[model samples]
Target: MAACAPDPEPRERGSRSPSASGRTARPGEGLLAQWDADLLEAAGAGDAASVTALLDRGARIEARNEDGRGPLMLAALADRVEAATVLVERGADPDATDDLGDTPWVTCGVTGSVAMMRVIWEAGPDLTVPNRRGGSPLHPASERGHADYVREVLATTGIESVIDRVNYNGWTALLEAVALGDGGEPHQEITAMLLDVGADASLRDRNGRTALDHARARGYGVIEDLLA
Candidate 1:
């Protein structure tokens, strides 16, 4: 299994650097750091009571740990729908991105969590938020064959129109789907849906081959015919 990458930056919301402690150490400094630690743990564990208690005690709701992961991000990663919902309702920014520029919506899309994604979307995440690679959450879902999640995102009136959106490599969601799909009935179905919805089947990637060319190279006869 691939190791889970750590968050690049850990924001110390209430922790004082050791340098500052040399001149004068405050009695409550230790207590404050401990409280922050508790808040992070509670958010990860999905303990609603603990979350509320910590926040009420002045914990930074958006505090990021060493990985730049906020409490809401942790909850979403854990698939705690209720906890995620609660955090968003408590004013967590749904559009908060990690150091890698992956937002809550992008995480949900990558994890294939339709329910969690809906929660984030309803909380007002911009579906068009692109990552460092210029790919939005929709690209991952469509590429990974998360059909239900893809449908959910695509059904959003304006979002569906991005089916032909190309990334830095000039590969659209349709290109990704064709490249990664198994070429079965489902793959052909998705490909057809993409094309019918205005995906530019003829659009080539950096390699100068259209999505159908890739399908043909991979022996996806049905998908190739459908695109053709």
Candidate 2:
């Protein structure tokens, strides 16, 4: 999800430098404060040049909004590949989770951008990290019918463990896909990918229902056939 905090208001032209309230400006604090919002703003807007320029002007690359979302996470949520590339190259940590327990890598699954995945993958994300919901990246990708991400994260990364990881809700990637998907072509593809990648379909939900059981109940014929 994109950072929920609204963009910070612009400082008035010719205003005094921004500073942390109730404290004297440190050597570089004022500069960082002035551009803190600018860095995140550039990232979310996919302005690689602006992001680079802001950083070059002493803007902290890790500056965050009220939600504690750094530049890389904002770029990830926006699917701003160019901006993310600049952030990553400038040492933004893809593995770093925000206040919501969402890392740039985790955001990739929700955004469904294979390009973003590639960018984050190069940073070597700790795939074992779970989001606030105790779900892996595969969970959202599966539920959202991100077939391309399902194929990439599983097929290329060779990480079968993600497929079977159960969320706090007792919904594994497989279960989430079956339970939350729309029973459409994209979802069918995701189901097939999960199965092919060794997702443990035998696992049951909190209600003790298997994926096939859910599929059957949902009248998802193709998924039922796949599961059967």
Candidate 3:
């Protein structure tokens, strides 16, 4: 006859069961989660070597943070040119948007990094996608008086027709330049670039004010002349 096994000891009262404590995760989940954290940190710090190593170690290239900011977007936001290049080359989507619906293109414009812009451009971001602020890459660039960004957008092959596209405020790139500019040389350069690319001076904002109107109202003599 086989001997009976001893009875298992009872758990103490109020002791948590394994299932009650937490859900069981697959083995890969733990590794992937750690990798996600490492990848985001590396990307935010612009550490291209660390980013590369993490990706090679099975980190998800498209991992995002709480704000919906993917690694590529982080690299762009941090002005990590090499890190951005690595992510883009690894097939990161250039058009991936963050919580504010800001794509890498808009981020590049905000950061005023032409080098990042070039890398993202090679990945084929949509030139016409608007951010949560109801503006495109050109809108923020012009609004912030980033002449180089404006020039880059104009120089890109397919964006010629979108130069005068309006944002949620019905303000065109030219309108933003005139409305948000400080009337400095940078704004002047941006306005000139828009005009040189054939931005319509006659366009109006949601307030029914044209770039010329805004320029005149702001006492921007040079901009008024350019629009005129």
Global lDDT of each candidate? 0.76, 0.87, 0.83
Q: If the candidates were sorted by their TM-score against the true structure, best first, what order would they fall in?
A: 2, 3, 1
Stretches of candidate 1 off by over 4 Å are: 1-32
lDDT of 2 by residue, 1-228 (tens): 896998988964444455668553443556558688888899999999999998886788888888989999999999999999988888889878899888898888898999999987888788898887999888898889999888888866656766688889999998889999999998999999889878888999989999999999999999999999
The candidate that achieves the highest lDDT relative to the unseen native structure = 2
Which one wins by lDDT: 1 or 2? 2
Task: Tell me the tens digit of each residue's lDDT in model 1 across 89-203.
Answer: 8888877878877777678767778888877777787767775568777677667777777776667635765667787767788888888677777567667777767777788
Q: What are the RMSDs of all candidates, in order?
A: 12.1, 10.7, 7.3
Q: In model 1, where is the ten-residue run with the lowest total lDDT?
A: 11-20
> Model 3, poorest ten-residue lDDT window?
12-21
